[model samples]
Target: MTIPPIVRQVVVGASASDAYAAWTRQIGTWWPLQRHSVYKQDTSVAFVDDQIVETSSTGETATWGTVISAEPPSSLTFTWHPGHGAERASTVTVDFVPIGADRTLVRLTHTGWEVFAEPLDAREEYRGGWVGVLANLRAALPPSSGGAEDVWLILEAAPGLAATGSVFAHPLFAEHLVFIDKLKADGVLVAAGPLPDEPGHGQTIIRVPASEAAGYIDAAHDDPAVAGDLLVLRVRPWHVMVPGV
Candidate 1:
C-alpha cells in the first residue's frame, strides 16, 4: 500500500528570499533544539557537509538528513533519517511560494514512509512534529510589515550591573554589536544605538508584523548578551508617526 505524504503549511510575513534563507541558512535559530532531534540532549543543529547534523552539548553528533536539492527563494529537498540510518530514510521537501511582496507561503511535504520499518507509526510521529517545527519557524522569522505600523524592542542592563561602569568596555560588547549588525542585515532592525549616558540602557527599533511581536521580543531576549547575563531586556510596542521615506 502507498502512504500519503505528510504536509504542513504556514504563511510567513517575510519576503520569499528572506524566508528561504531563514529556513535553510538560519535554521538553528528557530528549530526547537530540545524537542525535534534524535538525541534528547542535543545542543544545536546545523547543515554541515551537505548533511543536517545535530550536535550535543558534549560534542556528540547525529545525522538527521542529507541535502538533495537547493533552489534559493523557492524550494529545497533533503533526505530524512533522524534516529535512523540512511537505509530507512525518507524525503522532505519545502517550497516557498511568494504570495505578496512581504508574504510567502511555506509548505513542507514529508514522503517515502515505506522506507521505515514502522511506517505508520513513524508517519504519525512526524505529523505532530512538523506542526511544532513550523510554528517555531514562523516565530523565528522577522515580523512582516506593510508600511503602516512599526514595532521596536528595548534592552537594558540588569539593575546592579548598569552601575558597574562603561558597558561598552565589557568583553561581550563587541559580540553584541556584531549580533545587532546581523539583525540590521536581516532587515528587521531599523536603528540601534547605545545610550552611553544612561549607563545600562540601549534601544533598537525594528519593523515587524504585530502578529509576530511576541516572537520578536523572544528573539531579542535570545541575544547572546542577554542570554549570557551581560544585559537585560524590556520590549515595548512602538508606532512610527512619521516614518522617513
Candidate 2:
C-alpha cells in the first residue's frame, strides 16, 4: 500500500504546562530509543524540545520532528524521520485539549510519507511506531500539577551509588514521596506526585513560590533518601505560576 504516502489527524489532551515542557525538553529521558531507534550503532539521544535526535555510528541519524506549532499544556506539531539515509521524510502533529477535570485529550497524526523514495518501507516502519511513541508521550503528560514547585526533599542515601553515575537506580520515588509528605506537613507543597510517567524516569516538581526555592534545594540535600546525587540537580528559576490565567 506504500503506507498511503501520508498520515494526518488531530490530537487533544489535557495536561499541566510543566508536564508538556518535560515532554519537549527532556524527550531522550523518556523516548523508547533502544527498541525503536533506526541507527545501526553508536546510538545517541539528544533533545531540545525543538528537536529530538537519535544518531548512530553508521551515520544513519533519526530526527524525530520540530516544534512548528506549540501551545504550552495544549498542543504541539513536529515532523518525523526514520533515518538520515531515508529517501523520504514525514510530519507528525499532536494536540492536547482539556476534556474534563484534570483530564486532557491527546490527538496525533503523521503525514507526508509519499515524499520518501520507499513509501511502503517507510509506512511499514511506522505502522505501529506512532502507537508506541505516542503512548509513551501521552503517559508522560500528567493530569495535574501535583505541586511540583512547592516540593522539598531530604536525602541520606542514593541507591546503587556508581562511579560514573550511569545507572540511576535509587530510592527516587520514595524520596520524593517523603519530601512531598514533609511539604504537606509544613503547608509548603500544595500537591505532589511522581512523574516517572512523562519523563519515563524518576522526576518530581514543587508548586511553591520562587523565593522559596533556595531553601528547598538545601532541605532536599538534608533528606535521607536522595543525598548521594545532590550535585546532579540543576535548579532553574520560573518567572511566575498561574493555574489558568
Candidate 3:
C-alpha cells in the first residue's frame, strides 16, 4: 500500500520571482552540506543536463531527479531519486503562491512513495529532511520590500542564569535590549521576545541577506549579556512557515 504525500509550506518574505530564482539557481548556498546530500561531501547541487544533480569534490556525480515541469516564479515538478536510479523515482511538486506583494507561500508535495523499496522509511526520512531543506531555501533568498525577511537565530542564557530563573534580573538585561534595538534599527531584526513557558530562553527572527547572516550572528553574539557570560548564545538558520499579522 502507498502512503500519503509529504507536504510542507513556508511563507518566504520575498517576491515570487526572487524565491523561485533562489530555489532553482542558488540552491547550494544554504543547503545543509553536512546533513542532506547523496555523498558525505557534496561540492554543489545544480540543474544540469535535464536533471537535478549533486556533484562531489572528487568529481563523482549523483542524479537527484529528472525535471518534468519547470514553470518559473510559480511551480516546479520533478522526479526525485536521490539514492536510487530513475527506475525508483518519486515525484515532487513545489508551488509558489504570492500572498502579498512581498510575501510568497512556498508549498512542497512529495508523492509517489510506492516507487521506493521501503516506502515508509523513505517517507519518514523525507518528512524531516524537507524541513531543513526549506529552511535553507528561506535563508538563501533575499528579503522582500519594506525591509523584512525570515531567518532563524539561536539564544542561550548563561548556564546558571537559566537554572536560577534570574536572567531577566541580570544587570546586563537592559543593555541587551539596547543591543537588540540597534539591530532592529539597522533592519536586521524583525521580532524578538522571551519564551514565557521556557524560563530564560528567548528567540529572535531577523531579516538579512544570506551572505551577511554570519556577520549578523557574530554581532548578536557580541550582545553585552552574551559577551559578559550573563547569557550564552546559540544560532541556527530557520524558515518561517507563517508570518504574524
RMSD, every candidate, angstroms: 16.5, 15.6, 11.4
Q: Estimate each model's TM-score.
A: 0.58, 0.45, 0.58
- Index of the highest-TM-score prediction: 1
> What's the CA error at residue 15 for candidate 1, in Å?
1.2
Q: What is the lDDT of residue 59 in candidate 3?
A: 89
Of candidate 2, the 10-residue stretch with the lowest lDDT total is 154-163
* Candidate 1 global CA lDDT score: 0.71
What does candidate 1's lDDT look like per residue over 179-206, in tens digits? 7887788788878886767756687777
Q: Quantify all predictions' global Cα lDDT against the true fold.
A: 0.71, 0.49, 0.70
Best by lDDT: 1
Q: lDDT ranking from best to worst?
A: 1, 3, 2
Number of clashing residue pairs in every model? 0, 35, 1
User: Which segments of candidate 3 are over 4 A away from where they belong?
Assistant: 142-245
TM-score of 1: 0.58
Q: Measured by TM-score, how close is model 2 to the native structure?
A: 0.45
Query: What would the per-residue lDDT of candidate 2 be over residues 1-245, giving only the tens digit for each residue?
Result: 32322221112134445446656666666577767777634576766546777777665656755567778776677666655533454677655543323433344555676787776566556645655765666566533433233323221222221213322334454564677688778665534333443322233344553334434544654454434332123222223335432
